[model samples]
Target: MVDVAQHIRIFDQKPADELVPKRTAAIKDLASKLTGPKDVDGLMKMASNLVAAAKFDKKLPEELAQEATASIKKQSPAFVREGRDLELSTIALLAMLGAIDGGTKQGIIERLNFLSAGVWLGLSFQQPNKESRIEALRVEVLHAARDYVARGAENARERKAPALGAPLKPENTNLGEVVSNLRASVERLNRNAVVDREEIDFLWWSVTKWSSALDGLYDEASAYSAAIAFGLDGGARLRRMPLDVHKHLVLRRIRAAEPVSLAGLIAAVGDDRLRILTKIPDASTARTNPEIFPVMSSLLSGSAPKSASKDLQSVEAWTVRALLEATALGLINQHEV
Candidate 1:
């Protein structure tokens, strides 16, 4: 389903706080959060997601995924390469950093937490043992940078930012020709002969859903999260995930809402963030947005179909609770935007 509300680019730049002592204090607070080990579950979940991201959609072969990841690392410190395998790790890392830049202490802390978790997770999956995890972190920071590169590439492509150019420089040049070719290769590999706007919407939904909570208590995970949830501990594996589940459920609720409009839907959800999501022109602006029909049909009639609660008829609670219930049942993850 199309979300009419636009999304704030994660890379948007905001002015720095002008306070003096407060800024210094914020840095200390952020450091405390990053250097401490208080959130074990968060660390583990982050680790699993990074590993699972290295294996997203179960698409790219394992060895190749590793190589793509490595190539990315050789080029950038964060992500590996484009294509299905590195999608989640790449995007998450970029969005995390892009949003964190010289902001408040809280923002800096949040960014650091995610980054540390990402590094730990990357090591957890690549190393064969715990002892090796530390050893790898010490020895292979540069040797392994696919996840970092992947992050840069995605941010560059989505925001039309300048290229990393020749490998590691993250400034002032567009990777236009490079991004176009990479996108073409990925689509070709998918057997998607023609990637129109709808297809872009589909993949956008697929990738954006990679976000998850650090721990089960506070954060939520989705199919993208589950796909890359595998970690070095080998505790969590990618369970069977139904594609199009979230798209279907969301559209179903919207259609169920009489006199639906993008503005109204945002009003109902009450999430300010929804307003920032990039608009889906192909699916949302069309007469009746007919493109949503097929996607909606698959949801209502699919083998594991579940109906929305009568309570869900309203736009007031667009919490994606139904989807979370499915995640609880192992059908899908909590993909709330």
Candidate 2:
């Protein structure tokens, strides 16, 4: 009586008519089997057992089946297939892996929250809440994504996203307050000379815009390097470029604060994949997202100049100059990871 095939279609959002009885029967069958407490642990078990049995009986592929098995160890393989596409499957896989590997429910929740931040960021851009803070973040992400897309050789049709960067000061953008990201974009414009602005003050501001964007670039570059400095081996994809990422990061961090070692950076940020780890926070005192990605992207875009090199000489140059400001504040400290 359980119309399993019809139920799959219904859950998957496939159009199905004339299967009311069948769908009802399938739902009843599922309800009958689920008789215990409906907590996360129980839910996980229920889904995992069902998916694991399917895997063994159906003999899924090594990679997929392996993921299925790992999911079973935590809660359920149903999660993998339940998602609309591979993206959700990827998220589910990570979640299940975390659950199995002794990650607490709280930790799992945090990871899940982290995953959802991008969604919220996108939504915030589309329709920000009353709070100007939310609007601020929306602008940052839109600006970042737009600038990155503009730099790529992709078509305008493929690259067009909604305009998101609101002027921090619509009436008057103080030279000191220009976001590093926008500054970099403007600089790229100047370097490329896409069009020349006649106004000298405007041109000067544009130069500054590019400079701030460079800072963002260095922020991200350093974060990625920080991840490398930590133990990320062949994990996240590296940028397709000729930039000396590590040296760039080292220099950038030194500039941000005084001369912190690789260990010190690891201490401050906790990882090098500043590119990914760098998230836009809720504008607390702490800078949440790694400061390097926006900056690195800017510096690397639109025929920008390259990094100094991978040599210690370049590293030393960064340490002395960039970190000079941080040293004044006593923020930089040498320590081991």
Candidate 3:
């Protein structure tokens, strides 16, 4: 079996100085253009051009590439906040090229999250009405679900057989069963390449109904929390995670509301589990008290505890509950957080 974590480390390793001057010059030029309001579209085109250029040159380390992306997002929040698809798509394209060059599953999942977010954001910008927005979200959700199921199938194929005369561990056995079920679900989804409104309604029902079936097999809370963070962090992974696990995180984030930064989410959860899971830097830096958006105060006050504690279970529950509430209120679904 592939060691996903090890693969990520390999991709993260800094490359030796080769064409450093050229790469630096290219990045500096890109950064200069990214600073202006009108240059957002140009940046996106440049990102795509970079991807093509990367095909012939040595790919940048994942770390360097992601750093550049973060810088761009931070400098151009207006463009990102507006749900500019072209800009996001450019970021995804660059990441995709890096992942392809590196042959890392971690890279693939990262790319998918970016692609998925860009697609969803694009849909949101185009659909001005609530009903249309919901419809668009549902369609994308189905597509993401299908892609997840396909990935599960691939994982199933790669599963190694237990050593002869040795029984599989309980966790392994349970995972095997879950993968089997997932494969079966994919078979049903395959019958119709594009899921319609009626089909999506049925899927929603099925997901809710089968929620408990995977209880011991999956940690829904952790997955949901991670997704919230990923969404807030603009589809970037704060830490290393398997593609399969990260898929759940990103999908939930895509479905949930726009997340604040990691710091903001930690404050929202009002607990330590997320801090430990994502290794968040400092709570003091996070905007716990809502300023511009009073809705955030209402949401956090209702869900998060007033006092901080070491209770991880409460944190998980609070995060999941808060996200569900946000989803209902459509706070996390739209561009604004």
lDDT of 3: 0.32
Per-candidate TM equals: 0.21, 0.18, 0.22
Q: Tell me how many clashing residue pairs each candidate has.
A: 25, 27, 3
lDDT per residue, candidate 1, 80-195, as tens digits? 34543423233333223332332233211233333332443243323232333223322233223323433432332332323332332356254675676666666544433222
TM-score of 2: 0.18
Residue 213 displacement (Å), model 2: 5.9
Q: Which stretches of candidate 3 lie over 4 Å from their true place?
A: 1-110, 117-129, 132-138, 141-158, 162-278, 281-318, 321-337
lDDT of 3 by residue, 1-337 (tens): 2122222222234533442333333334343432122322222233233332222233433433444555454544332323323333233333333322232222223333322222222222121224442233234433442343235334433423232233355768666766666666665454333223323443343233122212221234444344333332322212211234333443443333343533445554344242332322222111232221122332334343343223333233334333222221221122221
Scored against the true structure, residue 278 in model 1 reaches a CA lDDT of: 19
